[model samples]
Target: MAQERRRRPARGHRRAAAPRPPEPGPVLELEVERIAHGGVAVARHEGRVVFVADAIPGERVAAQVVDAGRERFWRAETVSVLRASPDRREHAWPEASVDRAPEQRAGGAEFGHIAMTRQRELKAEVLRDALHRMGGVETGAAVEPVDPSLAPGVDPEAGTGWRTRVRLHVAPDGTVGPYAARSHTVVPVASLPLAVAGIQAVAPLTRKLEGAAAVDLVAPAEGAAQLIVRSAGDRRSSRGEPPTIIERVGVRRFTVDRDGFWQVHVGAAATLTSAVQDLVDPDRFDPAADNQDLYGGVGLLAAAVGDRFGANVRITTVEADARATEHAGANLADWVGARAVTARVDRYLDELVAAPDAATRGLTGATVVLDPPRSGAGRAVVDRIAALRPAQVVYVACDPVALARDVGLFRAHGYELEALRAFDLFPDTHHVEAVARLAAIV
Candidate 1:
């Protein structure tokens, strides 16, 4: 037996509905104000700061908002140029141009649209600004290109075909290419304009590599380019033996793990090595002192010291990567006094700090060369290094703000910036490599 139900009048009947979320604002018309760190142009819309990609300073552009959740600032990508800057040129890579949807453009070459000269100028501006604002130090340091003589027949100043190492991402569906700008999604690209000819020759740009998470292309200075495909999930190389290659920097040859960390730019190692040589005063360098190369990858900079100070130079290369340390030992074997210690830099510094007076005597006039990663050596490391009371500190930095912050920290510890030189190592990107020489103030 079924209970009888009353029939209700349902024609056009409805209850109050939940309110819809507010729709996103329309495309913004922004006047790009300046170039900021992280390879983006600064702009303002209705008093809110917006970081716009694919744009240059002094340009007006209509941009599509990519992120609006932040209360203080928003993020956008230029869709159309309202007023183009004279520095803007045709992008080096067509797939990374503003003509495409922001999400579809490839990453890596953020400054491809700007003239090469202007690109260096913007990098200089960013570096100077970071130093002034964060480090509280003023400098007229200019970013210069790598010496063309070091890379014969290849014009590094051209700012293209310089990358010796190129990593491409693989999508779940087997598409292979670089990740779209500021995203993890792989956007298949037709070419890699920034990769060296060797890398370009071996790069499988059109291939769909199933089961691969990423592909690493390595073109050592002396060998044919090698391609290593990393499988999905495990992220291990598909090949055996973990390929090693020979990289020639000047007259010396270094044995580097194909997949290990090396300067991506072809001439970067030589450029940095020369810069360090020039910055390190021979009169100040002590072959018998407890000198160090922190974050020493494959003993590149350590070799620079040896080259300048002769084979008997005593220097310890501290590295966290056991493999790189092993290679460093081999690469620096000619310097009988050089040692490669496998240890984290901070931990090594802690040991040095705790050592007895007899063991720490060599540190009195030591020169410490640290090529820290983009984050810089940080406060703890800086403080520890200062505790050692080294005579000189050579810092090779990739991130301007981090370098500036660390520089400020060093200054507080009585280290004065003696010399600073910035290089356009990564020309088509916001990244600039700066070598700063800081000496203990007497």
Candidate 2:
């Protein structure tokens, strides 16, 4: 039976901006300031951010723009550079990193953005701006980019595949693709450049497994990516083992499991892990210390740092969904350090003041690294963390809004923003990974 759809006009909601026809041309020239949330530059045509791909700062290039509404800004691509910036002349993607991986497989080419190295600085600046300008976190000094140490490289800001898993939506036509910018249109590609080498290493596995309802490519448990192509209604694909392939990173490679969580970009995994480690100072995990892993998705942070830090930190790997925590425990079981005690974030955090273990994780310089969902850390969690007054706090935020919100909360707790950094892990999309290190003061 075909699903019936209901049509309701916008009655109470504010109306979207008027739409315009796509500009006809090979490309039109426009001045680009900086890249927006997406990879395109934030150029103003009619006082709005005109996102332009393949364009960069200080360059005036020709672009073909398609009108988007209030939330859906204009779409544009740089066609030609009528005015050139010196940086673009010498700074190109392939030239910088020979293994340059891009969002799409047109081949890892450079956008007009001249200096990717400088892009990191800008991201750090944005953090400070958001904190000082938006969140009033500038009590002492404005937030600066995380020291170069936090950066993945000398540039310290440019990020690439350190992903362990990727969720590529299966289109109606059985075509797997990424959504174009914010648009629902699926943009197909021969292959993704930013995909961890391990994920890419197993493309042949797709040929072996057909009729898969959903293919989940995960770089699980600090090892190579394991491809678990699942089925929606069928039973066969669910039982199969992950494809046999070992993706290596850092110094070692572990056995890939069909079900596991690995950083998608193997190269950037160590950097991210180190950042998490810095957040909690996993080095401080004492055998007698008591801490909790709020979202211990696969226990990567817990196992990586907790084992070294010790079980003294009575750790609770809280996850409302029990299945995920079971896997997390299994993954971390071998570690001699603290283990995850089950707890739900919402309920547990709500009763923190009354909970006995609150003292265990209670302030006294305890560290908490809050990596929440896209929806971001809620008010209760934020308030609890603020009250606990942890000595050091590290936030691995995937979204800018939540990060901005929490920055305000942390500021209230007397935590100063020591380091703020952004990673270009996704390369082409508006999405970027941001890590903020907070230190508590008097």
Candidate 3:
């Protein structure tokens, strides 16, 4: 064999004089420091911070990079666990349920590294921590963790039968499901455990919506079993209904549409109503509120204060849509203190600020409530509010980022945060509903 020494494949051979560039690949040795708002594990690798999903602190693990921003930045989900932490052991025995993601099925894999409850804790902690760190609002003072009671007239513990509204995206085949986080893939749900028990009980209704572009399911306290179809391209139904249209809420008595924005959860109507009631004095309302509504759907605030609307409290229920506004008007037309006012909130707010005459559009010593879009108080609206300078303003917010920023802006504009309340309406998710009481310091 010495006569023919075989030559190697020349692998691992390097040109002696020329250097090669460093390889770009996943880094697994980063030290996780804290949790992010969206359940991502935040860690510092070398001199840069890395965000990894499904990762817990103090656990050394490998992550495959799925997204990269620029130099010294990347995000990954946990791929392999080299060492386990305390959290990894808590799920030695998990209660079997249909609420699980597909990856948790038999022989199915993905979240084997962590449990669901831990995920909830992580999401909550991140929310609390961000307020302390970024907003300078300490967790203890900014939000005292209250063992929040779910809305009255509902189930607890398991958090079942709590949803009244849901927005499910439909696939090409009309499979209705929630959009996977950061992805459009429909994570097929066998049964949504989060929806109100009534909604969960309606298996036939969901199957009927199989061909909708998207389905907006609404079940108010009373009414029919109605579903809204959202077809982007070619969604069809065996029942011969148009994809884009208003159907009904709570047993088909009341109807809503794609343009109308309702509370995401059924239980929220009660929770939000209570939040507003925490601010509205009973004296400001009247008894004949059947005709008087707070203007918005179901009049969450109105219903909460319905007993007190006798003192001529007809509020102009303002909305842009003729249909929803009409529907609301008809629903509330009987109330002596409530009237459906159709128009953009911005214009209504502007005109109100300019009211009592056109000379100075200045608002002074007024009382107002703001439930604007997620953009929060825009500069124009804020400027008008400042110019009008109300006495007391109640602000309802669903996004804490915008809430904090607006609170900071309002504080700068001489409004103090008198009282703040946060609700865990959408449990098992990072979203929160908050109310802030701001009084103009004049």
Candidate 4:
């Protein structure tokens, strides 16, 4: 064989070139313009929107792009403050920064680095922005700070020690702590500065919970503190007795499941109840005008209305959860004309809308006050409520975006957003509660 050329290795047998590692992202200096939703600060990098966590508006900071691959905008965290704002303060919870990564920081207290007053200012900016961008109605509705006088035992200067409810994660070693932002990593918490004294007192119970997945500490306004140990196998059952606690809204007392949804802020109930009553002004409406409370948890708003307008106001409260309805019925039992109906809000609205006119159905001039969940009462509910030509609709909302979207829906149905009041119920975090009053356009 003539010089048999050495056969090259078959293509299939050839070694593959090492896969290239992902390119390192860019780091740049950003001048934060304003605080955005989700506890982030708005900044621009080469004309691209960059949301920087742990940064305050009016500050220049060095940031690294954490999600550059995203198309519309980029996400970043402040690497260092190049120009600190007056609002910037030492983090209230230093231990929360156990990990260098912002997403790995302990949960809650996101605004610990900002002063309490400045935190409220930033939250107001966020609310205004949401209303303008989403609701398309930019009136001078402002976010108001809670006066310490409204809530007893609350310190005006101190933003900590207000949380009456806390959920802690359990680590493999039986230690309980908070989960890192957007992560399952648990950061051991020896102390919770944001929790009430009663919740803080039960910190030692974590070690006793071996097989528990997490623990919920609930300290209601009236009643002994209750600890609920959640297991990994079954989330429904608790290690101890079902924690039922009593909360007061004005003079009305409500018995609520400890694990259920209640305002995290200790003084939230009192403030919200007062705001709702002020806006709804049930006393102004006709006593026979039917009033409905959607998502009425333990009938707080119903109770408040009943207190103002008396039992002859013809109030009907709707709640989906069986347990909550049971508690609501019990709570409203003393009110003669106040009744609790168990039904999903959407389904109930569907029936109410399809039912004969107010005169025929005996539900005339209905005034609705709803405390819907974060997702908010959708357009269907708004349209049906509007169709009923209700004189007043009071909405209690937790998420600004949801409120803005629903505000749009209300406008589409010829309902005007007459008044909106924002509250800093959740301090040191992104959450804020808002009460909006809508009136049908005559």
Alpha-carbon lDDT, every model: 0.84, 0.52, 0.51, 0.74
Estimated TM-score for each candidate: 0.92, 0.69, 0.70, 0.89
Error of 3 at 115 (Å): 8.6
Instruction: State the lDDT of candidate 4 residue by residue for 1-442, as single tens digits.
Output: 0000111111121212334433446778999998877888889978989988888889998887777877779887677888989877777667554225654577787787888888887777888888888888886766676767656655545577788878787766777788766457667756788888888887653374567677768888897767766666554434465457788765678887765666778888788888887888453466677788888877878887777677777788887766677788899987788888888888888787777664365345667888887777778877778767777888988888888989988988888888888898877887888999888777
What's the number of clashes in each of the models?
0, 30, 29, 0
lDDT of 1 by residue, 96-213 (tens): 9999988799999899899989999999999999999989899999999888877553545457888888878787788889988887768998898888888888989889887777
Worst 10 residues of 3 by lDDT: 1-10
lDDT of 1 at 435: 95
Could you give me the TM-score of model 4 versus the true structure?
0.89
Total residue pair clashes for candidate 2? 30
Better of 1 and 4 by TM-score: 1
Clashing pairs in 4: none
Better of 1 and 3 by lDDT: 1
* Whole-model alpha-carbon lDDT for candidate 2: 0.52
Off by over 4 Å in 1: 1-25, 152-158, 235-241, 358-362
Cα RMSD, model 4 = 12.7
Clashing pairs in 1: none
Report the Cα lDDT for candidate 4: 0.74
